[model samples]
Target: MSASDSSPELSSEIALLRQPGLIGCLAGRNLSAFSSQVQAVAVGWQIYALTHSAAALGFAGLAQFLPMLLLTLPAGHVADQFNRRRIVITCQVIEASAACLMAIASWQHWIGAWALYVLVALFGACRAFEMPAQQTFLPAIVPVSLFPRAAALSSSLFQVACIAGPSLGGVLYGFGADTCYALCAIGFAISALATSSIRLRFPARQRQPITLESVMGGIAFLRRQRPMFGAISLDLFAVLLGGATALLPLYAEDILHAGPVALGFLRAGPAMGAVLMAGIMTRWPIRHNAGRTMFFSVAVFGVATIVFGLSHSILVSILALMVLGAADVVSVMVRGALVQLGTPDEMRGRVSAVNMLFIGSSNQLGEFESGMMAAWMGAVPAVVIGGVGTLIVTVLWMRLFPGLRDLDRLDDIKPAD
Candidate 1:
């Protein structure tokens, strides 16, 4: 068969690389990802330095996610109804501008924990709008046949950025916190500029009148899909419980006695593992007992989290976190496929919004939860307990939702009616 006629096994990378605007789109995403990682590492260290309080650090994390919860429905609707490229560019400008203000604040030595949190909250709001808009914009520009490749290329680039961003961010942060913030601002602006340059005859999807009913369509659809709900919920609680990322600052300060540079490597650990695993998965896709694979991956993630919490050696901790990241990436791949393949084109925006809502909140909310738990039980014990809780949740989810556990193939799981 011709390359284009090949089934899903066609080379997605080649197909996407041949496309025009895709390269620009991906470049923009890469730049954004880099800046985000830089901002994250710098802000985390700064918060710890300023407040010396785990709860305050958690609140910083909370500020980023709160917008995702509040604006998910409307954000998705806007992406679907409006010019997604314009929406995305506008949001990028907002984020870039916020980063600029943050940089100024740092340079002026005026940003305390509260000021930093407010800036981060603004950054989060931009992400709330940008994600859904950018996501939907891809399919509009690329041919439908090349979409699978587009997805693969996008995933690979994002993962690469995840690995590179922190390492670069950490190094830049060594110059100064202000330096890090400045880079974030510059990076976001560049990303916005690149995205704006992508000229395509892309058409936005059909829009509906803004109504509470129209906005809530995605949630209502997700409600009836047992496997989707089960998978997403399981991921939500597992991640929320297993997360030790927010406590990294504590670990660096108290346990490992590492500096910000070491913290950058530590932050990059999971992404490194994920990149290694993802490269292999792309070559040999998951085809057997997919549901079982997800459960196993999450279970592995829990165990790795425990190992990370207990380790005193920086190398061991980084290794453990790498394993945790690798496992989580597997879960990410499986769950993403389940969600995207099952949703129709028209509802894709809303469905994506719903997915983003769950995923984004779990991450930042998990950070907050980690902070509270660490404040109460101590970082080591808090992480250990959370890891254990993840294992327990895994077992309970498998039992409570047999349909999810028995999902042997992605092909068998249909879209919501």
Candidate 2:
């Protein structure tokens, strides 16, 4: 399409970005994505340096994710009760400090597997709190009417950073891994400042004082909601099984014969796809059969993963990964909007935290599983089988949660008062 042909959609999206609060939120997201990529490279290199084991690299990933499983509930409760902007800035400061600690260790040549592991564990713990606050605050920035478009735009910007950050990290590593670590620390500082700038108009709390029972009630609420449960679980298992990210270093060196630059591109492929899909979603909202679309998108994700696993050619592998990324983003957008529309305003924070836990846990645990499975079956076979597993799980999930597959439109649903 010509530039003029795309002008209307681009114009609409640009208008959304012009909203001061949304811009601030996007700034925060951009910095976070950059920091995440730098951390990925730093951890990948450190593990590869210490143990030279793909499994160990996967364990590094586990260190980051393990906290989400343990702290996600409390994080949700805190987000519901507190100032989300303050919460995000606080976490960013701590996360920045942690990155600096790792940089110092790398500079002194004192870094080891255990030290990196410890730092990542700490990082994960802080992130458990940060994510819920970040997500819960988005709807406050943009009006409820703009959420579908705004969410797509925000997710797209994050993916843009995902593409840029790793590619830059790969370039920076030529100087030294410590350089990348230091840069990531700076990224966190920027994230803190950006988050501090956002002006949130949160709805006043209607519930009584925060309590353990109230938080647990959120979990109980989820248990009774079948469509929400299915959507969350589907992404969790599909991503867990289909994840090949933790193994990118191996693919770069042993399989594709690419250097750090190529590894960066490989890592960024999915984000590139996600950005593309996000752009598409902004103009054309998915209105009907939302559940079925999610299933098909994820199933396509599995197919793309299978293609990526079997391909050794750099171009082919990148294409496969890009396809996978696009498919996953579609599912992500649909499911996220579904959760937002389906839950009550009072319950948004707690429910969002629950949804995020599964999503966040899946990303981390998927890495662990990928690393362990790759160690046993070797990378190619491991990835291929994981893709197959994702497909099977999707089929079973569809059968088990027909409600999700039957969802028609976000406009038709109403949150309980």
Candidate 3:
């Protein structure tokens, strides 16, 4: 379509993207996400190589996820009480430091499992703080008129980073672990520098007191919003049970015999599918029966995971992963819209903190769970079982949360009274 024929909304979104501040925010997010993906791939592969235990790989996930589990609420409050830019900058510096440590360990051939776990654990803590701070800071950089579009862009970039980072890291890892670490460290540094340059348009939010109620406010609110809670919780269980990402290393080295290079493509496959799905979704947005679509998508994800787990052929496994990724994006977008539109402004910070905790744990803890299960049942069996679990969860959750399943449109549901 010609520029003149474009819709006003499209024109507005394009214009908003042009703003230097928005560009910087988006770019920073992209770099930080990409860097994290690289770190995860390198670290997971290294740990597996050193220990050759599925449980050890699970432990790596536990080390990172534990901090998010422990500090997420406190971190949310800190973001409200402090300068988000400074908080973000500090987190980025810590992340860079962790990467530096990994580089040193690899170079000296002292890459013990415990040391790698400790560094990754530190990276997780930094991530805990950085996630809330960065989310808060996004709106402060753009005009209110463009904030929604910017938010959408930020979300998309995060997924893109997930798709890109591991692939790039896997490729770089073929050169050397040191190379992966060095490049990740540099990416973190550049992201921090870019973030430092964005201006915060708002003042620090009023601090919530350190009382029991204040800390528990988000949970209380979410409990009352059944449809929203249901959607979020559904995503939590579906992905948590069905996740096979933690098995990629095992597949690469043992099952598929793809090595690090093949692992990179395998890691990137889901993301690639997700990106493709996203492009299609963008052009043909879901306008009706959104909730049913989400349920269908999760079922697809489960089926795709099963295919990936069963496939002995590398190409089929990758294709299956891509389908899984695409299905996940649909579920995420549907659930995210429910959370975003249904949340009241007053509780957004706290509620979002809770949401982040759920989503992050679902991923990280799911990794740990997958690793543990693989160790017990064997990797292929673990994955297939998890996919079956996901399917079961879908049916159970649909029955339990009728509001979520029956809800048709984003605007139809009201926030709790």
Candidate 4:
């Protein structure tokens, strides 16, 4: 078969890569990911410095995710209702502007823990709008056949930024917190500018008056799909329980006695593993029983998390985290590609939005769980327990949803007209 006729394979991906706007969009996403990690590392450092409390660090993590919970559905609605490119660009601007404000606050030494939390809340609000818009917009840029490759490519680039950003943030923090914040601002600004240059034709949806009913329809649809709910909820529960990320600042400060540069390495460890995994996925797409693959990957992730939690040495922790990251990347790739393929074009935004809720909950609620648990049991113990808990959840999910594991193809789940 000629390349175009091949199932969403690498050659098909090459065709999409030849398109005009994709590179620019990819570049924008890279910069955006960089800025986000920088912001996170800086904030984590600042909170830890001020409070010397792991719980506080967890709360800082929570602040960023809380708004995602509130705005994700509405944001998804707006993405579906309007121009996705425009929505993405607007979100980029908002995020960049927020970064600028944060930089100024840092320069002036005006930021407190509470103020930082508030700023992160605002960042999260922008994120809710940004993610769905971007996710839905990709199919417009590339053919549906190339989505797996596109997903892998996007995942790889994002992981690269993630790998670099944290290490850079840590080094910059050693020089000055303000410098890290400034870098974040610059990253965001570049992302905003790059996003502006991309253009695409978006599919139109019939206008429906905004109401709770309208939003709930999407929720109800997702609720009825066992694989969709299982995939999303498994991620939510596993990550929330196994979230050792929120405790990194504490580990850097108290246990490892690492400086900012070391902190960056600590943060980048997972991304490095994820980058490697993403690159492999690019070459070899998950072809059969991808849901089962995701489950196994997450199980490995939980085990790695447990190892990370128990390790006191930086080297061991980094190794454990790298493994966790690798595992998580596998799961993320399968789940992301599946969701994109499974959801209808018209319902993509809403379904993506529902997915975002799980993403936010897994990430943010995990932070909260980590923080509260750290408060009660101490950071080390909390992370350790959370990791074990993630393993348990993974096993339970496997037993509870056999169909999820048997999911063989995205084309199998298309909604009937």
Determine the C-alpha RMSD for candidate 2 after optimal superposition of all C-alphas: 2.9
Evaluate residue 355 in candidate 1 and report its C-alpha lDDT on the 0 to 100 scale.
Answer: 80
The prediction achieving the highest lDDT against the true structure is 2
lDDT of each: 0.82, 0.85, 0.81, 0.83
| Model 4 Cα lDDT, one tens digit per residue, 162-192 | 9999999998887777888888888888887
Q: For residues 1-417, write the lDDT of model 2, one tens digit per residue.
A: 766787765766666777777777889878987897888876886687678798997898789888888888878887887777888899999989988888888999998899888988998898888888888767666656677888888778888988988888888888888898999999999999998888887777764565788777567777788888788889999998999999999999899988888888898899999999988887787768888999999999999999999998999999998999999988888778767777776677788888888887788888999999999989999999999999999999999999888988765666644
Query: Cα lDDT for residue 111, model 4?
Result: 88
Tens-place lDDT digits, model 1, residues 63-91: 99997888887888876677778878898
lDDT of 4: 0.83
Q: TM-score each candidate.
A: 0.92, 0.94, 0.92, 0.95
Worst 10 residues of 2 by lDDT: 408-417
Worst 10 residues of 4 by lDDT: 408-417
Q: Predictions ranked by lDDT, top down?
A: 2, 4, 1, 3
Number of the predicted model whose TM-score against the real structure is largest: 4
Q: How far is candidate 3 from the true structure (C-alpha RMSD, Å)?
A: 2.5
Q: On lDDT, who's better, 1 or 3?
A: 1
RMSD of each: 2.8, 2.9, 2.5, 2.4
What TM-score number comes out for model 2?
A: 0.94
